[model samples]
Target: MNEKAWENFIVKNQVSKDIPEDIVMSWKRSVRAGIRPDLKKAPQILNHQDIQHIASTNLLHRIFSQLSGEMEKYFNKYDISLSLADEEGRIIASFVEGQLKETLQEIRFYEGGHWNESKSGTNAIGTALAADKAIVIKGAQHFCENWHPFSCAGVPIRHPLNQKIAGILDLTSVNELFPDNALSLTAVFVQSMESLWHAELLQDTEKIRQEFKTYLKNIKEDDVLAVDSSGGIVDKFTKGSNQDIEHLIPLTLRNLKKGENKEEIPLENGTDVKGRIIPVKRNGRMVGGITHIRKERSLGAFRQEQNSDSPFSRLIGQNDNWKQVIESAKRVAARNMPVLVTGESGTGKELIAQAIHEASDRKNHTFLAVNCASLNHELAASELFGYAPGAFTGALKTGKKGWFEAADGGTLFLDEISEMPSSIQAMLLRVLQEKQVIRIGEHTPRSVNVRIIAASNRDLKEWIQAGKFRSDLYFRLNVGRLHLPSLHERKTDIPVLANHILKNIDNQFQIDACAMEVLQNYSWPGNVRELQNAIEYAVLYARDRVIKEHDLPGDLLNNENQRYSMGLHLVSNEKNRQSKETKISEEDQLLKTIEACRFNMTQASKELGISRSTLYRRLKKYELQV
Candidate 1:
């Protein structure tokens, strides 16, 4: 605390002489870069008064309310007070020993004060956010010399999946401690705060993702679209299918000169996707495009995209493989042969199966689904083959109809077919070959006209080789094969699926570019099902009507793969087309208009402010309502 000691400390580090004037300037620049830029109204405030008001807002109130009991226990152990800040760097929560209460309140610190490098030079809270990590600013390290008298350390709090910061946890005091111990203590405290934040994010992940799915449809991004290298229209946003925004216009994307300007690629679809396709280098050699998408959006502009409908309807997006699956489904449906569908969990194998059934000649007939995995050996056999009256202990008097019989003149979908016992497999193989089945305890076999669609997440052939699945049955059902691409394989479809689901919940789910990219970049190991579940989650947690990148599951957003940083490029053209025109924001709205006139494109066109070409374009673009 003395001048002599301060000089000694400076000298010991060699910071007084080794640092050049330019390096000093660069350090100042780095400090500026480390500060997180504050937004207007929400991120920006008129002054400390406004920040204090926000600190007292309901959002802060609830957060503090939840932490009160737990925080008390934590503070007692560390002998440290707790402080809370809103996203705007306003102090919302502060606690110390009862004796120091007056001093705490008397402090000039309130809310809405800037801690970002751009505003305050270099400090803990602002720098942590800009750096997106934990940091310490002890005494002299403080950005503003006035803050030097005290030592402060803060860490960024986020969901384990890395969703968003609820706030920050900081330790500040005049107490002196060994530097080595100090870092560890700060880490411990910050981690505890992060633990609390992560728990909340995980609990809310699904809710928020779902809410975001639907809510993003209403987001108003100046220029947002899915684009590839050089910025061609991979996809675009539209209000109504009938609106002629320009069909599949492919625009070339070029890089902007390096420096301050960000490159925005324009799409023929009349939208913008932001990012640059710079050389991605591993060890000096070029890899590919290093693209980026922004997650931040204006709150007011966000609510405009909210819509309400079933979450399932929003599953439209295109990938070559997905399209191949669709075309294969049509072919499989047209044939009378048994079809086997395979994919990892959540790839929508069942949906593809249903599509095949719907596209078949027997579209009008009933389609029954039975999960082979859910039935026991005896029950399973009886369930598939049917049981005659008095056939077993619990047999119905009239004899229950087998799935084959119940599904006569229609289609029978057996899910998880790999789980079927050898006995059941034999029975199923017979039905496939002869088209006949006899109820349990029945003497005669009755002919049935039913199509069979078998699906599983496992590789049936591999199982058969392992002796778990019957080779004969696998061969019978494998007459036609279809593989559903994993979510990662069809990363391009994320925005489409998100939009599709969101459109069902609410017609206004306009996806912001950053949010869309986050969805696209996620590894999606749980596949489509996981993506769907996450969307369902986001829906519940989203605050505004739009889905922000922050609403995504922490795991998906973490960029653990880091592949996204390079994989994402300008989809600016597609994004621009999304906001160009057309009014109906929800998929159901489009479907409703279609059904009102019996799916007649002409009638729907007039109602939807689009042309027949646009209608057809949409049908293809969104893979609309079957």
Candidate 2:
């Protein structure tokens, strides 16, 4: 392709607006083949029949099933009604609308029906397969003139592991109904479907994985063993064992070098359900072993050591705003300035702090946490600054080093600092300014070196104004501010966190894929904490082996937006709450701003806009198209 043609191709691939022509051409020449084109995924041909077809595919079936929920707002986003077809035009899954069910049944778009090029006459699905490339059948561009009323865009969904053509992600929409968005929605859904497919493929590998998971799940507290390719025990979590390592693990990697996937075996205690050994095959050889140590049939909590791409890992969608928040946190963590993390209670301020500390220089030191709100009046003052003998009533006989002293060479995390009494706020400020603190009831000051990480879900600006929190203290903590994206704002992180949790806890401990889907669509009101609790509860209540939808927490299932709908509106989560709290009504809020700008549509729209169409569509797929 020439530069101009390549440029157009590049412009088409990007979900954004026009790009520099030269840059576009450069990208096209760099690579083209095997890259799934976006044109194939548009919703240009969405219809009752389409939804019915999509509802059938295992990929879409699982994807949309997880999306089965109650939420007036999210209903239109998934619409979970799209019909997909294989290259040969064999109808897959679908969510057939009631009104069109009769017509759809008569047409060749229902399950097991065929719509290939030979049958339908050279269209998106058939042509894409024949040409071995994505194609867009624009309004009136259909090879069959009868299809002129609808436009179709389709890209072939390739098998994840083999990278071969699997099926087509085709979006059929009415001509001219934001045709451009159709392209984007198709692509986004296709990507999500692809991600689901990859996860499904991982299930095939689970049989091998189950070997270790089962063995580990039933293993005694100390019992450990490593197994080789044929499921033979190789080693344990540790070397020292009264029992023989020789009898346990097979002699294989003994001659191999250290760090060569060597096993670390835990001592054996009888009652190990059965030690399961899974081989880590590399280049056709069983290079190492992964052994699971299970004490109970129940699933365990996610041990961060294994950060697999599990369903409970994280809730990350295709939203730019939340992505920016994550990016901003990393940048803020790179500096030493005190970071004020603001967000809803469950939005993970502590997780961000932990992430920041792990990325900073003082990482090697102990991370000391002293909740200013958790301490009582007597302990609050002494807990922050070490106390000397007789410093106060019931003080430690000798002097006890406070959090400041304990975190002297490290980070002193102050959670809910706004709750810190006014008396101690003064001392905290002094420490921030002088880098030292005086022990309670002691005249002498103790020299301390610590990076103070303070956080609060409350608005300090308001507290400072109300005289509840000190202004000077607020300024100290505000040096480096990091605002966390609320659950609704970064809804994408929901899936990311969910997957992280599941991979860490579920898949290895128990197979609860269906329950994971339920967790994915849940609106975590308490943010990460609520999600953690729900999963923890489900892990415990799970009977019949794996956690299913019935095993999920009652509160989560009954009320999707329980947290947001209920009161606790913290600073970050309350951005919307604040607007709702202050604004009299939706129309009043919009009209007032528009009228203030002398009814300037563009300016008024800019003042409050992700756009009307955007707010209406929650698919994330639709936003990408826009």
Candidate 3:
């Protein structure tokens, strides 16, 4: 069936004979579950501990170790991702390649994401689990609109002993179609894993039995039990047939599955007991666990200490380039020297400077920020350096301490340093070299111990070449340097930054997946500041506290729509002569724009009113190099 048929089924509950019976049933089940058609991503229902438990399972660890190389080959050959999810549909492991890894992560297809039908709607993984068989879900067959651009196949892996479903082996393709052998390949992998699991269980059960005997001799006055991988009791040692100890078995299994090695279990008799579980492993695969139970000690109550905030805690970024910048800042923060931070406006230069100050020895002292660009040309010296009594007109009779002296034994941040007057730059250089500030119209110089952090959006090297800034001052300030990446250059951080912004506004507010996609695709010209404003605007207009696509600013939507239109136009005008002439002019314009932006794709795309992808395509068509 096509999109229209799918729409009819969803809107009117009318199923066509052309649609597969399994898909129809899945659709009905999804509707009954109250799954929204526009759901953007799978819910993340598992935490780090839960994922660790699944990953450490004997059977899964073996499967992953054995098949990782083969999975990588398949991913390289087919450009698809291979994922393993537990019976509950929580993804435990995924094998993906390069940029596709980030793309899939955006849709919550990574480890710890829940893909059960109740959570993620109708898809290969969920539908295959529901049917207890292999299935392929193609575009339009998926119940959720956000999943309509991809195709997926899933095969349920069954436990060898019980023939019951244990997990799922899935292959997903973003090209809207998979090879005919995709499902067969998934089944083959599952069959191999099950076969390996059967052999390992038979061999490990005997090893566990041998290991359990040694543990029994060491325990005295305490109950010890040996449990199989599935928590089935294999043997027990106790002073008597203690019924209360059996009650502890359930609690022990629960804690083990949560990846906890030790836990306090309170008995029905109001007696507290402590249980310690030690795993019995053969060849890196867990065979069973040895549980030791003893009376709890009457120790004082203890609480974990809260961690103190780091100076970089306020900085939010996960991109590799951004992380490197932060790391460099951290290294320089311990040294006593002048630092120069350079980046585009709104790229958090001042934040970095502040972080450096907070991380340094002078953090407890004053931290003063002066905007050199805003300083008056005539009064710049007087503002930066103190003036003696009756030094000039309107001067205070008692004299005044300038910013340099006021910020002594602390850090002083100078923003837009390139905009400082030429004479003031000379004075700043003198202060840095002499470690003293000479007051205006004063013979004596006052010693001031201060660390300087300078920031500028313009290229100071270019300004120096233009005779607008002093080379000596630039060199002194550049003792330590950091350049922050723009928001567009670090799009991977958009989701994190947006979520942080939302939490700051209201804990209940959230952004829809579709809205997040829009935010990620937009070339943010104003960097983090622009993103903050956009999120604030979205929250104000959001419905039901969820920021959907319609709630975004009109400019954001218009830009996306314009890019979509241009993409279509490019496809349709592939052969027209008039379009060829237009293309020639467009190619020249793109080249000029790239040169003007210094080969930075983000800025070039923003200036040209096109998406980065569109710009890349145009560059390829014209055979132009960056």
Candidate 4:
């Protein structure tokens, strides 16, 4: 049925009794959630920090990485998009192309956003996860009024061994047409990922068994024991009758600190025992400890003490320039003041923002991040401050909580703050000043307690001069300013970052010294993000599990000859190389914009930040056409 007919059906039947059985059931579920039809926006319940913690450590991410390219190809062909979400219904990753991507972003269908039945109402991913089964929800089947224009199919991916839902694989399209066999295709893909994950888990189990065997050889004492990170004995080697050893030793050797490791105890068997503890450390973390039990001995001295794992530990850099930024960030983390992080594009600004959030007192609370560059002025206002019921066309009938309200007792990291429209900047400044937010179509201002951490790749000062940013807002956000160095300035961290990325892949994926040198030599304009993409690409396509210099992207290497043939000058000088790289970046961005806009000149030109005449001239110069 058309959208108007569906709206009429909803208006005619408040109880939705005439609606399809599945849709009616979903609508009842939403109604029970206290969701009304006039809710304008969905609350951003999950934060980026939670999303990152899941994505970085989950096995599903690795499996999805392998399938993303193929899925992207399929979705692009059908003008649809694919998204992967954890079992909690938080979107972890998404793949979209063309104008459809832009449209999806307008409705907050991006990574880190929650899509559970309660948050997003009836939708494919949310409903599939809620029901623990595959389902298709077309236009008007959705409970949320805002999602009436989109059609989607979803399948829950379960663990192969445990048969428990691991995540959901979903396909969404703006078009209302029913997709041919889309549900079956999604199920097949999810099954393949499950199989791959099962194999990897088996390999990990075998590897752990081998490591345990090696650990047994290192024990020299008969009364010695090996325990896991949780202080449970994994294996024990006992030679003589040490019946008292069980009662003598501590049940769990988890709380002994260095320089304070003395334990003298009298057992119930009338035996006195003293033990020396030697901690087991792997990758600088105390995973377990070794205990030596004695019938009668003096307390042993404790050696060095190590700090517990801190969020700053994940920053992963030793360079002084990089460390300075981290140190500055840590100092202000306790202040609970607004922070502004500035850096070049792909220079790890978002990472720094996350690190700051992790280091702060509000770390235990939600740490939501929203890309200001992705939202226009009106959308940004509603998304950041929320809206009343019936705020605008296609808005949900139930009033919704935005990021600031959702993160009331937490922190909000606004990425690309410089790209935020001037009008929204003024409102944001007011929010910071008054610690309150007024939703759209509402006159009452609600008090909120949210810490602001804003990041920008662009210079806000320049934006202010260009009349695109507010100077007063800049002053408010710049209270804790941090400037992150580009990757080229901190080349020493490249090898470490590369190793970290490679560890996510299988053992077969190897990078040699030659490849490392090539990576270090090239000027990484895109910084760590570009390096990560290169590693991902290499891992995905590497033959025989080895990544060589040949497998690296051509642009990363100094290949001026290729540029010369492409109607661009070949430059050998370092300065010239930098300039040429900028030109190449511009051209690549232009082409990407054109493709994403579906070759629409007007949209492409606007997105490229160039005039139509300039875009046309460049298109002709590159021998391209619409």
Best candidate according to TM-score: 4
Local accuracy by lDDT, each model = 0.57, 0.56, 0.79, 0.70
Instruction: Give the lowest summed-lDDT range of ten residues in model 2.
Output: 304-313
Query: How much lDDT does candidate 2 score?
Result: 0.56
After superposing all C-alphas onto the true structure, candidate 2 shows an RMSD in angstroms of 34.0
Off by over 4 Å in 4: 1-308, 558-626
lDDT of 2 by residue, 267-326 (tens): 345323322333443212233455433333333222322332121123333467655666
> Candidate 1 at 160: error in angstroms?
55
Report residue 583 deviation for candidate 4 (angstroms).
Answer: 28
Instruction: Tell me the TM-score of model 3.
Output: 0.44
Q: Write the per-residue lDDT of candidate 1 for residues 257-349, one digit (tens) a residue.
A: 121123444545667644322222111111122222333454333333221212222335678888787767777778988889998988887
Per-residue accuracy of model 4 over 5-124 as CA lDDT, tens digit each: 456645765543456666667767877887766555555666777765555345687578677656745556247778898888878888776687777777778787778888778889
Q: What is the model-wide C-alpha lDDT for candidate 3?
A: 0.79
Tell me the deviation in Å of residue 229 in model 4: 19
Q: Which portions of model 1 miss their true places by more than 4 Å? A: 1-315, 559-626
